[model samples]
Target: MSFETALKTAQDDIQATLTDLLVAFDGPVGDAMRYATGGGKRLRGFLVLETSALLDVPRERALRAAAAIEAVHAYSLIHDDLPCMDDDNLRRGQPTVHRKWNEATAVLAGDALQSAAFEWLAAPLTHPDASVRAELVLTLARDAGATGMVWGQALDMAAESAEDPLTLEQITELQRLKTGRLLEWPCRAGAILGQADPVHLLRYAADIGLAFQIADDLLDVEGEAATVGKAVGKDADAGKATFVSLMGADAARDRAHALVKSAQDVLLPFGTRAATLAAVARYVVTRDK
Candidate 1:
């Protein structure tokens, strides 16, 4: 199958699984949860499933992991859109959770999704081996918590107030922590499931993750809100230092392409098995939203 076809399939399956898992969460909070997760590229979830598939892991177990990552992603988006954070009013071309319902509902929905991620990871259905499940839970907690994505967020908030703008090196580290870790987790999780080394996929994730962020920066600079599905030019309006702001659009685009090449190169050992992932690296930089 083509990469686009595979991606669509993965997106559909992950969405279905995620929706089914959240069926028990009823009422406004549940509605917000479902609404928050309704649409996206689903790239992170795709990484989990694709990497796991490359290693020959069972689709049933990998689907749970894929949904788990997406749930965590949705939770992060919900919280990130809150008034105290990015204060985004739009997401996925719709009113953000807090706007659609209310702050309280958004908070509860995000909280529920975050906890539910761990719940799904801990279940035996994710992996029969308790150790595998344990690793999945522990890794996700570490990645999404204080030392990883949260740390990145803290750095971002700090950068907003600091007298000096973040240097390129600093911004790279910030994005690595805030964004790279979660992207890396899927590859690591896939490796754990297959009992294989994740060094190559880890490298691949690192490169692609940065490229993905650069793409997002480009979208903010060049894309319309209607096209990008959220606020555009917020970084510039906020005087935030971004890849585009620091490097200029042309240089940033070049860098993203370079990163995509590196990402694809690192997956060479996996050969044909990594084709879809290579396509994903290209898609990361080229996507409109």
Candidate 2:
């Protein structure tokens, strides 16, 4: 199948899995969880599924991992939109969880989603081997916790108040933790599922992750709020230094392109089997939203 088709398929499957998994919970939190996970490109989940496929892992097992990552991603978005955070009112062109319900409800919903992600990873359905499940759980926790995504978030919050704007290197480190780790987790999880070496996949994920962030920076500067489905220009308005702000739009775009090339080049060993994955690297930099 084509890469676009595969990506869309992955998105559909992951969304269904998330919906089914959360169907049993009946409450405001449950509804908010559903709402928060309702729409997105599902890029991280797609990475899990695609990388798993490259390793010949079982589809059911891969699907569980994909859903787990999506849950974690959705939880991050919900919390990131909180008033104490990015204070975003819109997400995916819809009211953010905190705005739709309330801050307390949004917090509870995000908390539940995060917990559910670990629960899914720990479940036998995710992998028959307990060791594999354990590794997935441990790595995900580390990557999503204070040492990873949270670290990035903390840095971001601090950056907002600092008298000086962050340097390019500092911002790169922050983005790697805040965004790259989650993106890397899916590829790493895919390798774990198939018991394959993850060196190349991990490397590919790192490049893709950075490129994704740079693309996001570009979008923030050039994309329409309606098309992007979120607030735009907020980064600049807030006096935040982004890839674009630090490197200029053309330089940032070129850097993203170079990262995409590096990402795709690393997949050469997989040959045609990795075409879709390679396509994703290019898509990250080229996508309008």
Question: What TM-score goes with each of the models?
Answer: 0.99, 0.99
lDDT of 1 by residue, 1-289 (tens): 8988999999999989988899989999989888888889899999999899999999989999998899999999999999999999999899999999999999999999999999999998999899999999999999999999999999999999999999999999999999998999998889989888988889999999999999999999999899899999999999999999999999999999999999999989889988999999999999998
Top of the candidates by lDDT: 2
Clashes of 2: 0
Q: RMSD of each candidate? A: 0.7, 0.7
Model 2 segments more than 4 A misplaced:
none
Candidate 2, residues 1-289, lDDT tens digits: the string is: 9888998888889888988999977889999999998889999999999899999999889998888889999999999999888999999999999999999999999999999999999989888899999999999999999999999999999998999999999999999999999999999999999998889999999999999999999999999999999999999998899999999999999999999999999999899999999999999898888
Score candidate 1 by TM-score against the native.
0.99
Clashes of each: 0, 0
After TM-score superposition, the amount by which residue 11's alpha carbon in candidate 1 deviates from its true location, in angstroms, is 0.7
